[model samples]
Target: MIKDYVSDITFQNLSHKHMSFERVFRNIEQFMEKDPTGNFKLMFGTDSQVFSRETRFITGIVIQQERKGVWACFRKVTIPRRMTNLYERISYETTLTEEVVALFTDEKKDSLIDIVLPNIYKGASLSIEGHIDIGSGKRNKTSIFVKEMMSRINTIGLKPKIKPDSFVASSYANRFTK
Candidate 1:
């Protein structure tokens, strides 16, 4: 039933149906601006699922400031045909994460960091993390591809997380893939 490839660069915001990257970026900006004193983690990750004759991928962009609040949104990309290769799918997922991360240029990241720097002594901070859906457990089918995928994420300077700790990818993004 899958038609063809579709790419949606706009993000799905909690308060709105679709937003351009700029709006989504500002949304988080306003979110953090509301409480710059809370700890923050800006996370990005991607996950995929195979439908009847195609594959659908969803990438989540999340910002969590604990007690302050958490903001999340996702973008979807689809391929016309089902992709059964574990390695291929995982690679594509990581690629999607990288692409999204690139959108938040160094200048943009520094701006976000600027918001939390003054409170560093007070425990306020920010970290950018990339989550890959692959795992390292022996029985995990995606285990074999962990190194390659993590390396890809690492090349872009994102602290990579996997399996149990990679909820952004395995959980958040996975929810939208369905």
Candidate 2:
């Protein structure tokens, strides 16, 4: 069932609905809360880093499932005025499946995390294991890479622009590689 939704999703074309960070996180939080299993955890954090001679904000959110003494956790790192991606490798447990492994690889190579800023969205994919796990009580700390792309869309409305073909066509500057 999850795979069906995953396959149907054109991740690159997420509607650019102009929403407050609070609204975005709140919507995501609500979605996570509807888990069938009565086990969910949410935490938010913030940090600062220097970029191009200026300090910028990096916000992170962690969601986890703890049931039957097992745990599955996914962390999303986002920068204000920038979109997020899950293509880099962080850390993960050894007991993982091929499909999950492939997902990370594809994400690194061909997936768009989020579209942020003017004409820029973060992109890249890396293979990190032991950070993202499926089923029961497991702990993984996978690191994903995100890039900023330059484009011509103003993502500030509830019905944000979503054009995958055009989005993938834009050029990126200083794309980070591993």
Candidate 3:
């Protein structure tokens, strides 16, 4: 059973009325075909905001091609009120990102993988980046978990990016969590 159900997702920059996980991959492929020369980066990230009764988690997938702007999709999930610890919240956010990545990777296994694999393995500059909300700034409380969270993301074979650089989480998804 899917414990964390995703409700009401949409691609922020697309005109399409409805968007699903499969559609997200399809849109990326179509974008690649339309602009073969453009440098493309796929990013996945999650952020959360706590309310009095629940915690809202927002996960986003962004496809960016150099100079051509960006296309993104987001899903929001709400869970019952829980712990307020910073570490626990960050860890939960990471888990949400991992879940999204797994779902997308699994969906890409049959058709999209063949097309994406070449770009990925042939040094074509195409890659996937996992953006974490943690930062290294002195004023940021999440900074302390940078190393540990980065290590976790690295173990999953994703290029991890922390704040100042992790806009997918800190900016895009963060907006929806509110």
Candidate 4:
């Protein structure tokens, strides 16, 4: 059953008895990895404005309950200054598109309700804030800066941290690839 969820969606199946959160992350990482333009602006750009605008950042947030769990790993990929506004716009657009897709797909629609909806509130929303650095200077310091920024944003009464164990791809997701 969990394998079904892993399909198309990047995830790893750790165990049959338990769901593996790592799979979700692996998939998310893979998705972002496939993107060639992650921090290109950060590297070879001449303009400061251009540098700041095009750095990639990623972070994971979660909500946990005794009987339920919700996790979302977000990749805040920076685009060029020209594309910043469009990127933010698409950031919002992607969620809407997912909702529409879920709405149309019968099985997904039901799963969203039966599985995803119950764990998440009707209007639950989480806006994670993280920093994007162009160069690799002071990795520890940079990481702390991003984490601190993200912590300030309230996750709408959701749990602060939830980590998954392992990852295995779902059969459904595998079908599309190999």
Candidate 5:
């Protein structure tokens, strides 16, 4: 079974047992090798759902390769620390996404960096994006933090995605958090 702490984090493929981080990277490498011309994007995002006593945070790492489709793995944590403030909650979510990105980028494999395409200029490069669960829609108060969160992501040299576009967080991670 999957645990809620990073130290015990496990990623699954289909119905099989959870795989370690190293194995996950190896799988991604093999997938890329099989499709050299595939358009790939490596995105990290997190979303949270608060309950009465604790909050659940789910972070997801998604590999989106054109034609090959999308593959994602997630780890979740249920914390007793309740974040009643909206800003605090959003910041925590961003931090979770950042942590996941750091784990992937800090890997010893140099080739992993080449797969992270941050811009179009890099030929067939894999882009690493942070999908923030904020939007510009007036109905949602979270929209107010879009600029602030975007700036934070930009300062870290990563592309930021808001709602309607931040499916990795608002959609993928959201499913597990609930």
Candidate 6:
């Protein structure tokens, strides 16, 4: 299920509509290069929507600086069958997000880090995170899987964020899941 969506996925943002992951990586580098002293955050997340005959899962990758603009893109995965199970859908979403997060290897991350390292004394910083749509709230159905999902992200060494704070998944990615 994972490979089906990731292997040949195309990422797109507002300016570009058809881009490979490699291109997206370069865009990230370029965005950082433009303002190396700004505090930057790189985030990955996934959200899904089930239709009558299929389910559409969208994963988004975003980089931004608070009060500044953001560079973002998403890839969609469609499953022929409907996924009625809440837990299964949520789990797969997490898996999808994790797989994308893994694409940024230590060296790749360090390259981005290196951009800001020189200006750290001036408050330049970078933080990478995995965003989960689940939130621990009375009305949030995904609250049940918070622990498991967060642990999954933690296992991969990426900081995890949930709803309200997890705009990448619940907001950005969700926008395209429809």
Q: Would you estimate the TM-scores of all the predictions?
A: 0.92, 0.25, 0.82, 0.24, 0.82, 0.93
The clash count for each model shown is 0, 38, 0, 10, 3, 0
Model 1 steric clash pairs: none
Alpha-carbon lDDT, every model: 0.88, 0.25, 0.78, 0.26, 0.76, 0.90
Q: Over 4 Å off in model 4, which ranges? A: 1-70, 82-106, 115-178
Q: Which 10 consecutive positions of candidate 2 have the poorest summed lDDT?
A: 169-178
| RMSD (CA, angstroms), candidate 2 | 20.3
The alpha-carbon lDDT assigned to residue 53 of candidate 1 equals: 90
**What lDDT tens digits, residue by residue, belong to model 5 across residues 1-178?**
2224444666664444577776777777876666655678777788999998999998887888866788778877678977789999999899877766656654533575544444335456566688999989989999889998888777666789998889999999998887
Reference-based TM-score, model 2: 0.25
Residue-level error in angstroms, candidate 2, position 169 = 31
TM-score of 6: 0.93
Span of 10 residues, lowest total lDDT, candidate 6: 1-10
User: Measured by C-alpha RMSD in angstroms, how accurate is candidate 4?
Assistant: 15.9
Q: Candidate 3: minimum summed lDDT over ten consecutive residues — where?
A: 3-12
Worst 10-residue lDDT window, candidate 1: 1-10
lDDT of 2 by residue, 1-178 (tens): 8667334322110243233333444454444434433343332222333344333322222334444221222212223332222221111111111222233333322322221112232222111111111112223122111111111111110111111211111111001110
Off by over 4 Å in 5: 1-9, 12-18, 106-110, 113-123
> Which of the two, 2 or 4, has more lDDT?
4
As a whole number from 0 to 100, the lDDT of residue 135 in candidate 4 is 20
lDDT of 4 by residue, 1-178 (tens): 6456534232222222232334443433343233322211100001111244453322222222222333233222234444344334323322322321232244522432333333344432222212122122364433333343224212222112211110101111112222
Question: The CA-based lDDT of model 2 is what?
Answer: 0.25
> Residue 149 in candidate 5 has what lDDT?
88
lDDT of 3 by residue, 1-178 (tens): 4423433344443365457666777787887667555677889898999899899988888888877888788767788995489999999899888877876554563344455555654544467889999999999999889999998878776799998899999999999888
Whole-model lDDT for model 4 versus the true structure?
A: 0.26
TM-score for candidate 4: 0.24
Q: How high a TM-score does candidate 1 get?
A: 0.92
User: Which scores higher on lDDT, 1 or 4?
Assistant: 1
Model 6 per-residue lDDT tens digits across residues 90-172: 99999889878877879889899999999999889999899999999988888999999999998998899998899999999
